[model samples]
Target: MPTSRRYGDACPIARALDVVGERWALLVVRELLLGPLRFADLRRALPGASSNMLTDRLRELETNGVLVRRRPAAPAAATGYELTDTGRRLEPVLDALGAFGSTLPATGAHLSATSVLLYLRGSGRPRAAGTYRLELDDRVFTVRSHDGRVVVVPGEPGTADASLRTDPVTFNALLADPDALPGLVAGGSAAATGAVDRLLAG
Candidate 1:
């Protein structure tokens, strides 16, 4: 069993923090939320963590009743880790954390083109069966879904149906508060051309 921390006060928030307060623990949960269930997958998602540390954290979470392991049936011989119902209840907490992080000072670094592409890959709404394009500034991007997988490629201008041309900082601000986009753009702090409006509409 993992060692449990003791707090004099019985506040639920304190209790919950005690269980997950260790370094990389919450990130492990974030990887699980992104649909990686196997130990190897979790390890890959958290690049610098050692196998031993991963094992210990997994054991701790399981012991705390936040996660459970199950063997796959039939052809797949893998054992996967999944969140318990108690763990699933942490989704809102994670989402709120994400929202909070978006407002932090360093969040602007996460608004790169690759990050935007990954966000679209993970959360974009599917379109009618057809290819679409996205453009930002002098760069052009192509978006297509093949075999239920979304692909984003940087290419020439006319390739995408829409384009968004805003700097990383402005984009982060807009994501933090969509209503503020126009003011930023109007103030010459950011600029958008092509189908930028359509991309923001969603």
Candidate 2:
């Protein structure tokens, strides 16, 4: 988008939309929510986007101070893109969008690992203090719930009060039907089921 591509309005919402109104802009932000991502990783997460379009969107976001590109730390390392503090503020916006979009019918879209992780993080709202470990296939994430909120970080915790391990399909099922957890849990850990229930409760 050109520097002049804007709504030419004074409203805050319009100004904000002017910066991120283009196609694939916000989706790019969504992909980078958890952490920085190399160009290849971003392409993998957004298979439909062309290389030229991706580059243009990245440039636009960078120019707007929404994200920054980083150089490789190692000789063989790939350059990556990470959100700026201004960009990180979009977390709640993405969460609200995801929650609202969930009401729509399924499109059979392929959910990438990051997409699943984002959904889990967005859906989580723990009422009490606890540590819950979630394993999605080979990926492991530690979710710490305290003060009526939750923080999900990658990797297993040293000591977790509860844990849930399952593939993406089963995990989605568990979210859709909390009552079906007992049958969905591979190990039938009640603690894990309870943890999932609390974290994903509507």
Candidate 3:
């Protein structure tokens, strides 16, 4: 059974924490923010979280209505996890948190796919303005940037001005330093062909 560690206080912030106060809870939410993910994929994305802890967090979050377990579809036949509407509401909060967290000193910790995508979404102010398809290790997403805002949607876009394919860490590296794109591309670790700087430039 999922346990609730309540604050016993009536404050909204306290109430919110009561549901997601446990360690690895928010990180799990972060992983699911982009799209649904199977257990193995979630585990790969959150390597530091133990299976038992992640399983517990998922269960608690599901019970609290932050996320829900998905049944397997015909072809895939693999169960997954996705955010509920209440869970999706946490995006702006997490976005604000991501922005605030970026100001602190560097942790030098490895960047996950969600972290990289969040960084690009929050900090990117691209000169380019069009849809760019990004294929990260976890899955596919479409990035559209215009003016100063960036929007990321799950799955392939109707059309893309360019495409970039790479793993999380390498993608993070290339995005953070666009100058490395050429070298990374030549090295075959990263591939991009389009106005990706619009999606990458922060």
> What RMSD value applies to candidate 2?
4.2
TM-score of 3: 0.90
Span of ten consecutive residues with least summed lDDT in model 2 = 184-193
**Candidate number with the higher lDDT (1 or 3):** 3
In order of lDDT, best first, we have 3, 2, 1
Q: Say which prediction, candidate 1 or candidate 2, comes out ahead on TM-score.
A: 2
In candidate 1, which residue pairs get closer than 3 Å at backbone N, Cα or C atoms, i.e. clash?
133-160, 133-161, 135-163
* Per-residue accuracy of model 2 over 1-202 as CA lDDT, tens digit each: 4433788999999999988888889999998887888899788778888898899999999999999999987989999999999999988898888999989988865666667767766665443578878876556778787876667777778788777777665666666677887664546532264555665553
> What TM-score would every model get versus the actual structure?
0.53, 0.74, 0.90
- Candidate number with the higher TM-score (2 or 3): 3
Q: How well does model 3 score by local distance difference test? A: 0.84
- Candidate 3 has its poorest 10 consecutive residues by lDDT at 119-128
Whole-model Cα lDDT of every candidate shown, in order: 0.62, 0.77, 0.84
Report the error of model 2 at residue 103, Å.
3.1
Question: Which candidate wins on TM-score?
Answer: 3
**Compared with the true structure, what per-residue lDDT tens digits does model 1 show for residues 71-175?**
788676778888888777876787677666647776223333434454555454443333455543344566666555666655643555544556544654564
Please state the error at residue 60 of candidate 2 in Å: 1.4
